[model samples]
Target: MLFLTRRRKVQREGIDYEQIDKEWDWDHFLILQAFVGATVFFLFPSLLHGLPLWDLRGLMVAMVVHVGVSEPLFYWAHRLFHKGYLFEHYHSLHHSSKVLQCFTAGFATPLEHLGMCGVMAAPILGATLMGFGSLGLVYGYILFFDFMRCMGHCNVEVFSSRLFESLPFLRYIVYTPSYHSLHHMEQDSNFCLFMPLFDALWGTLNNKSWQLQKDVSSGKNDQVPDFVFLAHVVDVSFSAHSPFLFRSYSSMPYTFKLILLPLWPCIFIVMLVMWAWSKTFLVSFYKIRGLLHQTWVVPRYGFQYFLPFAKDGINDQIELAILRADKMGIKVLSLAALNKNEALNGGGTLFVNKHPNLKVRVVHGNTLTAAVILNEIPANVKEVFMTGATSKLGRAIALYLCRKKIRVMMLTLSTERFLKIQREAAPEHQEYLVQVTKYQAAQNCKTWIVGKWLTPREQRWAPPGTHFHQFVVPPILSFRRDCTYGRLAAMRLPKDVQGLSVCEYTLDRGVVHACHAGGVVHSLEGWTHHEVGAIDVDRIDVVWRAALKNGLKPV
Candidate 1:
């Protein structure tokens, strides 16, 4: 029934029909239960002994009496369920979906549902006992109650300010969609559903509810994307394989390599089949709620399928997520680590070429990451060591250091790339050197920033006092027998930032990686419409502001 309303839907920010479809599975159960309950109560009612139908005046009185009594009863009952054990066992079920829908209002455990039913029925039952109730009043209350509940549960705000503007006092008596939405989001406020009267009286009203109600009512986020998805894939083979397997696979006996080569096609076919069949749909929905109110939906593709054998699968998956994000109206999207590498190098080029209509601007987010890393580097340190000199991030950092006239040691496997970077450097800064070496060569440096490609074992080589910075997911692992190493991490911005919009992830502990953080920064700045690829040093302050706002203390 609610799905029909979605056809000519209220325009709100972050309404993903795909996400709605995924959640609709649970609505069937709720609908079926409601149908059974209605059938039992009305069609074959054993409880309504004699239908003592009442007139219009009696119905009006019953409505007034119902609100007066039900408010306090429902308030206390709701509060009690939120207490310790009851919350963990029952109330949490209702709180699970922070992004509510009309059908979701009735989506609760049988016990909780029964409790609500009893609370609503109490006033009507009392009126019946006093011989003042009618079948008309009972049915009227049921329909009206269901309508109000749906309005409250619907994520879209339904109330206009005109009525409230005329009568400001109505806010105390009438709760809006945002009133109930805040309860789902904060869990501690807006406890009274019938009216804010009880919640206000008991000091349980959320401080931000009124402001949020005003914001949503004005359609603040109507133009912006409802959610932004950060898409990436894991290296399953790298995770699953042993170090020996990697070495052996790279340089095995010529005959053995020949034997394995024949199976390559078979492996590819199997991987393709698995990827085709796999459900590359919605992975998770994140409800970000601190500084701003919004939702981020992450839809995953089976990108890790052809791992160790081939990397072609990654491109397909990135494309899949990109198309999906576009459909979800995610104006700004960032590719995570390997996904970025694949997309920018070739797949990304092909995608933009093929789909000119796609409005989503893809960003690698390397600009802010480099800025965060540079800002974090100690001023006292004399030299900086960096691996993956050929990577976009490495190149940006290397160029930045060259311009600053600081000593930097850029390490890479390609001798040609090293020479090209060194040759391009200013003649005055010969100290900005490039070398073809591994992690071992950077031992003497006090500052170490490595790419994501470095293994856990290789990372442990950083000297004792060295402040190691890694801009990678799963972060740099520490295998030190004794926990005594100086490690640095990206930091979150203060709650109050001067001269900058406070845009940040509500969760992730303010600890978001540079790539995803970049997109978030762009979104906050209202620059989702523009394309951002390699950020320049002069304009790195955008990333700085975002990092400061979203960054947490390094772990």
Candidate 2:
């Protein structure tokens, strides 16, 4: 719920999400300890004795205690915390985080947390004193309290004003995220815990709370992104690492999780449902130098790409996403992962050809990709072995290296394709391009560029000390431990990237796939041409220089 709400933030003001990510440790521990202590105290008979497991009377009593005692106490205590000494020494710690995430509810100084713990205990103690306490009531009240705190601090408006309009008294009974957000921003109003009735009675409610809630819930503040990266899932398990599912997990490079293994069947079922009913949806968003950039998922998996029958369906999804971006006046839409597969859509050529008048630039982003891979090869090296030699990236690498007077042993069974690429090179350098059918033909070459996956037996052909550079998806297995393998071509994003809390695939923080960065450069340069179809080999150096000028460090 928190993740869904955050995607539709009520307050669009900029906040350092990275800073907030770093500030969660101590407060999280403190809150966990408090909850555990409360549970232990209520369960074992330390102060208030453990009662029956379930009782209707205990449930009713818990509500009364909360409304009559807990709510008022918290309201007054919250207001007090905003005043002179309390505000400066303790409460200000919580208020320091101007942006409210769900965890923000528990992010407070120990003293403020202590007071909150006390307020929570009031309801359980009161129920016990009234001879109606039960184990169910204690657990129920505590869980409900925690839920309300998280909801208020979640920073997104989930409640509709229509609910309040239908039940007018509910406004005084329950406070919304917008209402709590105003208290954080304004600092002197809307000082309620879970109910606005206390604030109403004390004449401290913010005047804009209701209107702001209505406006946000109705989506009046949503902004159109300037650039969108059209991406797809890599596999079933890794799909759980999406930013909307788990912030901490998505913030780091992904690895197979043993814990997630048990959930594979469930996740696979979700994939089926998505294949059946899902449309393209926003996965994450961030800003770079005031430009709104978003990542949208195509709702298909990597394995699906290899299934010939699923090809058209996948392209249909990508086409829909492109048209949608164009309709929204988006400037650029870059295809990522299999969304730009050459065999699938000819590296986004189908859409460009079908809709030639598209105002939105459809970019395959392989230009920078070719540049990154090409630059990774040592400039002094004279000869290199290339696999998947006839593919888009392979052809470009071969031609570029041939022009540099470097020998490129192109591995392919097709003589026709090799000759076509060979002819594209300058006549003076055409001799540098050599065609080889067997992997053993390049056994003497130390520089191996792999575009296709190599099996253990096939990998044995590479002599010792050979370095394998790759642009392959699900990068080839490191079968030969003696050789060093390069990761998929990638680059680090600029230092000023904002609200980027999720990592791109297996890349580290602040780093993205080279193609992803390519799209970013295209948008930043305001290039009006569509970077679709075949990669312009001539523009490889241009994109590389532009990336460097824009602060994109090669990784």
Q: Give the TM-score of candidate 2.
A: 0.92
Clashing pairs in 2: none
Q: Which candidate wins on lDDT? A: 2
Assess candidate 1 and give its TM-score to the true structure: 0.51
Instruction: Work out how many backbone clashes candidate 2 has.
Output: 0
Model 1: residue 181 alpha-carbon error in angstroms: 9.6
- For every candidate in turn, the CA RMSD to the true structure comes to 14.4, 2.7
Candidate 2: residue 304 Cα off by (Å): 1.3
Q: Which stretches of candidate 2 lie above 4 Å from their native place?
A: 1-7, 13-17, 26-54, 165-168
lDDT of 1 by residue, 193-284 (tens): 66888898999989987777776666553443334544432332221111112222222211224545556576556445645654342222
Model-by-model lDDT, in order?
A: 0.59, 0.85
What TM-score does each of the candidates earn? 0.51, 0.92
Error of 1 at 469 (Å): 0.6
